[model samples]
Target: MSDWEEDWDNGDSKATSKPYNKRNNAKDNSISNRSDESGRHRSSENRAPIRYPQAGEKRSNGQRHKHSEKIEVPSDLVGMLIGRGGANIQRIQNDYNVRVDLDKESGTATINGNTEQNVKDAYNDIEHHLNNGPGSRYNSKDGSSGHQSNAIYNFQLKGRNNKPGDTDDIEMDPSGVIDWEALNKKAKKERAARWSKLPELRKDFYNEDPEVANLTPREVARLREENNNITVSRVFQQENVSENIPNPVWKFEQCFSAYPDLLEEIYKQDFRKPSPIQSQAWPILLKGEDMIGIAQTGTGKTLAFLLPAMIHTEYQLTPRSQRKGPNVLVLAPTRELALQIEKEVNKYSFRGMKAVCVYGGGNRREQISVVKGGVEIIICTPGRLNDLIEAEVIDVTSITYLILDEADRMLDMGFEPQIRKVLLDIRPDRQTVMTSATWPPGVRRLAQSYMSNPIQVCVGSLDLAATHTVKQVIEIMDDGDKFYKIREFVRNMGKDDKAIVFCGKKTRADDLSSDLTLEGYMCACIHGSREQSDREQAIADITSGHIKLLIATDVASRGLDIEDITHVINFDFPRNIEEYVHRVGRTGRAGRSGTSISFITREDWGVAKELISILEEADQEVPIDLRNMAERFKSMKDRRANESSKFNDRDGNSGSRGYRGGGGAGGRGRRDRY
Candidate 1:
């Protein structure tokens, strides 16, 4: 015999001397067939002795010899192979008559059997257990067990030529026939399983108020109708909801009766009824449940959260002397928003309920003194709050109510880390309320991580599109024509009609404001580069009607609630839809109609589609050129995305290899470190 045959014969003598177990032959034929189909047989000169059963293997009743092998198990599959109480592993050991050892930390499995086939069988069985376990099924087309035919068939089905009644046959390889029925059934099953996990309402257990729990379905429906069909949806909730949770009430009197002092204050402010957000949010928040309120700007969202927080604080009855610091904390994104919230707090600060607003660019010593003096509520920006916390001047442990107003804007302004730091100092069990004009992904992530089974209340569509209260007029023109067009629009407005001219940059706002002032238009500018005092003064001038026209950037886009502003002029269209929404929202406040005129240039083409959609949603007449530009922009975006994806795929493939062409060890040599 040749040397290779001699080696195979020598190895088989040891395997043949051992007794073969009958269970090892269960899948022997299938394995042999697969090996033959895959051309797994090596040349006779270099072949290793086969360990598994051959095409016609018989049981041997001779003395057995031990055989061993090691297999690596995926970390995620380790729990499944071990099973509960080691039941699956024990069963495998008993049935296979082999010893199996598993290293949990390293995720390695060692199998030992009296015969070679036994060890192979035990290893295969362990793999089978893992494959059938949870999260084992590969979903991507390139996955090990994923069927390329199924993916191709699905792609073909979605192709344009494969419509109903079309007799065009999908070409298939004869050697690899597609299983159409099986693929269809599997696709349907996966789709159904995915849809089964769609979001659904669950009972809320956070609020245990007996009054709120006693609410009936009939009463809830009546309240909803009275409040113009306000809806409350839950993204996530717990079971064991209190049966005493109160139903939503429409009017402020119906809800605020429990707080006579607050009710008197509301009456003093001439507020007859609650806004939609306030009406829906009061019941949930008053009952001590976390909430996310999404409403348009100037829709009374401040009062919606503040009122509940105040009522809850009153219920706690914590003495002013004993209170370590502010019992309620309201975090705003900007000094402007912080000041605005403080102004509203002052309106409702009846019967010794005091509030202090802290923000950056103000006197730190003054803010420290106010906070040290003890207040029931603290309204501040994130940066200033963090500064106070680090300085050990503010103790947030006593804070029970945490409110994040204009939350989406806060995240956009990159205040997430500061917000998180401030939250870390507060108690986790505090009732958290997040209010935003829009719900972006970042805002959603913050809500999910911080809030406890919060109820979401949306006043209108959550898209944050421009409200119908403002009429949008798109003026398509060249960059050179923008100034003249804005000037003409401003001149046409009545002298009493106040207008805000929005620019793309602070310098642009400054230059435009100067030009407008020189042209004899009463205009003043406010932007981030301006001092806080100057911004405040400019806002005051605009609010007091001393300045009929104001020029600014997106810094003034949020939480500047001036009444009857009449006009908002976009000298430069916003690059994003959210900024556009807030810019226009500056006007159309407190039941007053306003006009927004946007001067769109070539630079603003990217946002044309979204802007057009907002205009269409508001029922405004879209300009024909704007519609065409939006379509062209959409096509360009799609083309660019496709090109980018293709380029990435090419680079990824090239990166997998050591190098395409190189002389220095296949580009694997290390470079000198600096």
Candidate 2:
């Protein structure tokens, strides 16, 4: 199970049950002042991929908010299909890899999956079974599924007391602007493309010289090794990269000679040359090509897209006043990221073009007022932006440059609904660029669905590879010894050295901060449970050197860009391998060398194999015991799978699917699966 241990909100990341404030309700008095996090005021929601609450809801403990689709069955056939002792339901859960909350009294079974596709598949299968069950009235004589009525009732639960599909405080748009019909229509169109779906991972694309059509993860990693961050053609192309793709610009003048204003901004920052990603990304983005930028954090991804967005906005034939919405739209996964992008946009004045970051937690009216007044660029989190769109305060019809920054992270936080909702209204022909550290299936699926023929630009390896600049150290120890291990490591740091301690849980971070503080360490902590303002202060302390240590969860892993961070201590190995890469990335940033210390334990055996692989990829030394643990875990898993296969064979059931309830449950799972 993931951090939430609950199914994702059908992969939409909407508030399944717990809603924040009503749309356009009076300003939330509790929230005051302008916040940089264009995301909602997350109450420590942690890394729950199921539900991302809006402004008013509380998720301090980072619990899962159950959003479900309930199907009403005839009371007579319910028991028959359910099977005795709920055996049939358990089989469905294991077979389809979904969750079913049986409401025997109501004769309704609630179905949910970690992703949208999974939920839809499970729902369809259940409906089929119900129709074919013993004495099912819907069953046809030809062994075909009979005409099924509307048995599924979908609802977004509200409040703590409400159950799945609860119908309280549900709001509807009378103007037909935010209706489901139009959104579904738009979604149906996005799926028409051949590459819109995630490719099955069974094929091997890792030969010495792989075929051009096979763009597998291993092949991408191999290309990263061969290219060594240099721009190359065809070897890494996804077949869609056209013959005349623009060449990378090494010198600043070579790319920006047309825009002296932009050149001046580059000089102001004292930037000498284009970074690896920026070198290649500029020409493609400036050419209005849809792109997927696979680069690490702090590699200047913002300017790669932002500069082009400005150029695109200025060249637009439509007048600013006549345009319904801003010509450029930037969707960030978190409030911090949205705010960061807006700040970058501010650094360089682009024809006096205005930009606003709208996220959760901030005063909505202030953001809306900024957009309504007039703006050429809009930087916002998905929820807040969606709210503004539904309220009709902002229009996306005129948007020509759309950016999904940290696109993979947005999906991990379950912001797909907000992203998809906003994209539905935008023109399909817009130039879209999605930047991500990892190219997971979810992000790829999103690109295929929304983007035109996209050119993939990967600076580093795509196989969950670690930053080569960072020195990775792995320690095998008991949980009791971890505190002392980190303490000793911190004690040896230089005066100017700064470090971030990452813990898995919010309470663990708070507890560790307390422990470290009592031991006379200058430290602060931030996690999903922390308030937006507190998170700001924690980041501020580390950046200003006011505190030597900043304890954090994955919240600070991606967006926080403090250049002087000297070390990263994985007080707890991250929940997954991709997160581990992101956590370590916080330290080794912007060409700066850094060190990362990770402590492993027996219980974390499942992660051992990938950990070793990441270590090897970075040329970091791996302990012998860690490799042993990985082998043992792999053997144990295979053994269990073999036993289960035999059992399934005896029972005459299909159970060959791998990794149940893990990554296999959702197509969006990290491709770093061992």
For model 2, residues 1-674, the per-residue Cα lDDT tens digits are: 23221212211132222333345321222211211124233331232122222324433654342445779777777655455444455445544446665565666777766666556656776776675555566443444332221122122332222232332323324321223454456446655552233221111111121233345656544544554464334323456546555555556776677788878888999887888887777777776667888888878899888887887777566555666668889998776677778888999986888999887666767888888899998988776666566556777876778999999988887778768877877766677889999888889889888987778888866767888889999889867778888888878889989999988777788888888889988799987656667877888888899998999877777778788899998887887898898888888787789999888866677788889999998899999999998887778778878978897989899666565322222333332111
* Residue-level error in angstroms, candidate 1, position 45: 81
- At residue 421, give the lDDT of candidate 1: 72
What is each predicted model's overall lDDT from 0 to 1? 0.70, 0.68
Compared with the true structure, the alpha-carbon lDDT of candidate 1 equals 0.70
**Where is model 2 more than 4 Å wrong at Cα?**
1-227, 230-242, 642-674
Per TM-score, the best of the predicted structures is 2
User: For every candidate structure, what is the RMSD over all alpha carbons to the true structure, in angstroms?
Assistant: 22.6, 14.4
Predicted candidate 1 versus true structure: per-residue lDDT over 263-342, tens digit per residue: 88888888767787887788788767788988889888998888877776666654556556677899987777889999
Checking candidate 1 for backbone clashes, the offending pairs are: 210-244, 212-244, 212-245, 212-246, 213-243, 213-244, 213-245, 214-244
In model 1, state the lDDT of residue 282.
81
Sliding window of 10 residues with minimal summed lDDT for model 1: 27-36
